[model samples]
Target: MREVFQAELKSIGDELIQMSKLVAEAMERAYASFETADTDIAQEVIAADQRIDYLQNSLDERAIDVLALQGPVASDLRMIVGSLRMSASLERMGDLARHIAQLTRLRYPNQVAPARLVDTFKEMARLDIKIAHKVTQLLETRDLTIASEIIALNTSVDKLHASVFRAVAEAEWAESAPVTADATLTSRYFERYADHGVSVARKVNYLVTGEWDPELSAALDQD
Candidate 1:
């Protein structure tokens, strides 16, 4: 019976890693579509978000089933509970990517960010993709080291987010109102994407250590 329960728990962990990978792919494709205003790729991302949603729902049901049948305790209990939380974070991250893709689709034929700020958006994409990749690694390894890197990468993303707003606030920012709206929203989506990555990393840390870090708790409190 103990072996059966352990196997079930392992299955849940595998599913979580799979979900994380799907979310990361969503971010990458969304960034690519955003850069080129490619509706085809943007549409692909929007559709993929639904798959992430399905995974979240399915995982929650499985976790609940485990609780009801297996009666997991101690670290096993922590793993199930943390999997649920991490799934939520991954789903939200997927939504953020979809939102970014929506901006691209909405402004089809016209670039979203101003030409001058394209490089800035590219940097934002780079940081976001890096964090997303780290999230998958953390899920697989449950290494607190990856969690620390995720937090540090999130800090960089936050700085870039502020820069986006700074450009919008500048006197020389002469883009039209529509372009300004795209810039504002695109920046926000990327920022939130990174935030969700940090949240998932924290959950992984808690799953392994069985103790929540105060810094992660504080960071989540603001969300």
Candidate 2:
């Protein structure tokens, strides 16, 4: 029974890795859509989202069965919990990527963002790729230190997002908003995507340390 449960846990890990690859590719496709204005690729991204959702649900069911049948404890407990967290984050990342692709499809060849703002948004997308890559690495290595590093980068992404908002507001106030809206919206989508990456990294940290970082909660503080 223990052996079977262990095998089930390993299967869950495999599925999560597969799911991450799909979601990561979906993100890459989202950015590619922006550059190429390729509605076909964008629609592909939109369509792939269902696969992510289904995988998460399927993984959850197997994970739950393992827990119920074998009653995992100690490290097994941690791995199962972590796998669940990772799947949820990956699922949300897929949703974010799908949204960006949908938004691109809705308004293509129409100057989505101001030239300068679009450039900044492009940078944001590159960062999204970085963050997604890091999330995959952390999962494979289970390196809490690397997870911490990724979490720190999230602050940098947040700063960039804030800067984007300020830039968009200035453009609007200057009566040059028409070209900047797409850029602003794109940056927002990338920011949220980075957020999901940070979330997955923290869950990896949980697998290693059994505790969530305090600084992330601090980031939520407004006072």
Q: What's the count of clashing pairs in each model shown?
A: 0, 1
- lDDT (C-alpha) at residue 46 in model 1: 99
Per-residue accuracy of model 1 over 1-223 as CA lDDT, tens digit each: 8898888888888888888899889989999998998999999999989999999999999999999999888878888998998999999999999999998998899889899789988998999889989998998887899998988888888888889888889999999998888888888888888899989988888878878898776654263
Every candidate's lDDT? 0.88, 0.78
Scored by TM-score, the top model is: 1
Deviating ranges (above 4 Å) for candidate 1:
218-223
Highest-lDDT candidate: 1
Per-residue lDDT of model 2, residues 1-223, tens digit only: 8688768987998888788788889999987986778899899999989999999999999988988889888988888988888899889889989988987788886545555566767777777777787877777788777666776677777878888778756634452455456566677788888887877776767667777777654442122
Worst 10 residues of 2 by lDDT: 214-223
Angstrom error at residue 50, model 2? 1.3
Residue 138 error, candidate 1, Å: 0.6
